[model samples]
Target: MQIRCNQVVCLFALVTALAFLSAACSGEAGSLAAFLTPEGRQPEPTQTLAPTLEGEPAAPAAGTAQAALQAAVEALQGTPTEETVAAAGGRFPATPTAPLLTEGPSVTVTPGSGRANAWVTVTGSGFPANVRVDVYLAGLVSASALAAAPRSYATTFTDRDGNYSMSFAMPSTWPDGTPIETGTLAVLVATEDFGFRANTSFDFVAETATPTQVPPATLTLTPNPTATPVPTAMPTAPRPTAIPPPAVNPYAEVTPLSGGRNAQVTLRGGGFPGHSVIHVYLGTFDAQVGGGERVRYGSAVTESNGNFTISFTLPATWPDGTPVAPGRLLILVATEDLSRQASAVFDYVVPTPTPALNPYAEVQPPSGSANTQVTIRGGGFPANTRVHLYLAGLVSVSAAEAAPTSYASTTTDSAGNYSLTFVMPRTWPDGEAIESGTLALLVATEDFRVRANATFDFVAPTPTAVSGQSWQGSYYANPDLRGDPVLVRADAEIHFYWGTGSPDPALPNDEFSVRWQRSLWFESGLYRFTVEVDDGVRLFVDGNLLLESWRRGERRVLSLDYPMQAGQHTVQLDYFEHAGDALIILNWHRLSDLAPPPTGTPGAPGLLFSNHPWNNQRGVNQTFCSGFESECNYAGCVRNYRLVWGPYCREGDYPYIRPGLYRVTFYGIGRVRAGATDYGSSRQLFSFGQHEFELPGSFTFCWPGRQSDGYGFETIAQSTGVYAAIDWITVEYLGEQCR
Candidate 1:
């Protein structure tokens, strides 16, 4: 089989050699067909050979047979085959290598441009020397190339380094059948050696041209260019001119001098740095100019700065009088050019020969109370002014007659300011609720005729009920009066509610109630009580009479403490009016011993008392047992009796006591026997003591009655030892004892 292969190879070479010779000689393109023919001729049709064992077909190995067949076919067709070579030689074909594909700087094309050029540099590696590159146009190339044609260029060898660059100009002309548009131009680089090929595209566009036109230029020249000639009209030199100065203003103001005899006039508002003069005018009434009477005073000239002032004295013998009527003084200032003018009229009134007095005064209380110290302050009076304050109505000097109404008075000071203050009387027979009244003040001065008679309103205070008491409990009967009675009845109680009923945990214990009550026959005429009860309450006097109660369903009272007296009283209390009930009561007696005792005999128990000889003795010996006691006796028991001072005492001076279960009694006698002598007397017996006193925190008292003349009674024997401090007292009724 080896020998046969060698013979076949030799035969193939001979045939190929013959075909090439034949083609060269014939010089005909058709003669090259001989190379494509099979190599050996066939035997006669009759000489058939039997199949040999070696010739029988075995299953072809995978890949080996196909690869062998491909190689055989390429060799027969004279196509180039890939091969590995150790070195390069002159026999190697010179093929153009593929260029490195990359982007370049972008070029912008205007809409009307017919062509655009992109300088794409082609670089190659592993390329043969002096290679001829055939550039083929990729059909899907950019519109720039489609509207143009494919272009070609040649490049030289890159020496031993095997690198070269060539630039090609892509034409803007398109192939005959291709349309002009925007597209990509794909390029392929290839060579005969099959060693170089690159597939890539570049972007470009094709655009149409716009229409435009340009105008031609023209020229002109002077007729004679040789000699310079003078023109007929020469520019006239501008004549030098001067500007006039601005106009000046003319106006004046006239003011009266100290005594009105001379007038000072001032000129204002004139244009400076200009020659201008002001003219004075005195004209009569002119109907043609305008209606109205006219009188002129005088005018003056202005300075360069446009200001001038002058003093003009009026004629001593003018029309009206020595001082002149406050009219007919008219002044006018007019410019010399008569372009502007200003006028002023002055009317001066002389001061009166005698001054009048101002009528005004104010009454102020020193301590701001009904029994307040009042001060009368005023002005507009001459020196030695005497002012008298009287009751709103009556005018009298004696305290007895003026006791109902009287005020302090004082002489005016140098500055005419006067002030007088005095103790305000307690009673006002004209009525405490006075609306308006008069205060007479007499003024004596040489030139000023001033009389003092001031009428003013005696503003009364508005009454307000205090806390802790109900509507009918202790309240201000007359709030306007400084000493207005704070009337409170026994068994009467007041209720107060506090705090909002908000459902907040933080304010859980906020709501509370307060109660106020008055005691029956309480020592002090006025009584009050307070409690921290949060509901409605009903107050009862004498344990039965309903003095006061809260009808509202809300908790109105929060906390209060008031005064009380010595009587039967009951308080039905509730807290949070709608929640729980609570109450307090104020009970007191006006004539109780709770009042301050009067200053007198060490052990006496009445407001007023007398001390005389025990035996009615004119001397230590020879004494009458019972007779009119010496009015001048200094030390000796005469007789002591009890009397009622009043219904109640002032509440302000006493301390408040709590109420619980208490035992009370009166201990005093109206008549007394001393040293075998019986004497009848009038005295006051008053006393108070705490029994099981139980009260909540925060309580106080308010009592009624005058503070000055209130007293209480105490036993002389029991109270004599240590300045008469009584813990308890007893009262005994004397039926017809001395009477």
Candidate 2:
């Protein structure tokens, strides 16, 4: 039997073989002739054919590929674990997931006839936009092969219209030779989110077979004088033009990104000209902001495999996160030569919830100002036991305490009630804004990931002149305010901008203070005042000390929000420099200056984060580097930081969601450095927003309410100096939850 094993059955899975074997053994066998039919006849779809008596083929088990793959894997190595999966770049999973889609997507070809590896323009619709799909080619003896066997290759995604069209060269791996008379190209889309999956197929015209050649006739003996053999010219077809290879479209993913600032996001994608530089731009969704408005974060060069990954600190240029940040920002990645481009959206901030943190916690009176008391209550908690409180950002209900983050801490009452007064942290550890977008208040109890959180109002007051006026500068002789400075200067409504230079020329290089005194007016509402300082600094409003810090060679900030009347108030900023260099920056803002608020309120912090030794230790789990293992392990270096994302409360603690105003505070010990100078001894300094405590330090996230059965929490503490760590995160709860 002329069995076309190489072409006629290029992709026969064991399914067809086993079925044929069973029927043959059961006295109802179909002959191998079913598949080895003559050139003209078509075979039935259900008819199965056995391999030749030579040997069985290496056909993969189709209907049970998952189970078969599992058994083979176990026999060879061992069991699969999460660690192995994560290290595999999330591309492959040991276990097969659910089916992609029930109704398969379809593909159509333009001018369908083409030779092997020729460019064919295929259009696809009815698929989700901006998502990836796999494209490939396969061949068989007849069109019936479409239902029997298949394979896939190259990956792509759809456009905003859920449509995609590309002129792609056929994959070189396509089967050839005799039995593979017909072929088809296919597109495959699959994802874990929302169970999205689809496959589209289109047939390609078959190529003409080679003509048989004839040998010269033995006519020498019959050749007579009168019949001299006439020579004839053979006909030759013209050569066809060669086609170029298909260019790969760019594709990438940015990790730990939420369209927010201070985060170091990673963009990873491939399929470009190898080793080429890519010009990337962050612009409005499907819109490009021109000239100055355009912010190019950085550039990346593709590796030899057309894949490149670069890390960058997310810029605060788009102050608001996600929706409000001029809608969604489209990240356009293009080649350096200004040739090809590929783009993706920020649709995914966090990964799909693992069916664990659904039904998030909710709180009343979600947003408010400092010292404002609120309630944190949620279900899924046992009654009558104490539960630990942890603060975090972007509350997604999970089963762990959000630690190794800037969330402050507290404890709930026996009835699962905890009251707290709001106190904004002076030392916000995270580089991202505590109030990115509207704010998502995430609250979680100890040993439980379920968090209850709420938002408070920005409460913008009437318009007021936000500029500082009647400014005065003075220098002190001693680091201690023992006497008045030697030199002084003053400016009416001054706009002073300086570097690490000295404030006064007459004063010495170290232990000098430059205080700016002015009278500022405000509308009848809340206003935020921010000051950036180096070394020791202090601020007083209306003769009341609003913030203070005493440190040397450290950059710190003191930010505060308070209510004020329509009249002018006295503002005094006390600043001092010790040794090295110094810098001071100040600013103010109100809520009305922002764009319209987002529709959905954001997360809030009702958890805690600190280096405080809990359970007779610092963290339930200890990490050497930046605490965030994902980034640290990837970079292959351990930074000077420790982290915790928690279930801090032990079981049976029964942490109650109490009611109160809450705030953030932190303290740590580390060595300080002077600007371009070395300080011989250790110095102490304190800071809030624009000030820092050189020796001891403190910070907090805007606190949040408590909840149950959902929200996940995270925390981190880092230092640039010679090893700095936060001591404790405490949220001052000030309300009644008893009864």
Give the top-scoring candidate (TM-score). Answer: 1
Q: Write the per-residue lDDT of candidate 1 for residues 57-98, one digit (tens) a residue.
A: 332222222333343333344442442000100011113332
Which digits, one per residue and each the tens of the lDDT, describe model 2 over residues 364-420? 566653223344555433344344434444543233333534233455444445544
Cα lDDT computed for each candidate against the true fold: 0.33, 0.42
Task: Report clashes for each candidate as comma-separated counts.
Answer: 88, 106
Prediction 2 TM-score vs. true: 0.22
Instruction: Give the runs in model 2 whose Cα sits over 4 Å from its true position.
Output: 1-469, 493-501, 556-558, 592-739
- Supply the global lDDT for candidate 2: 0.42
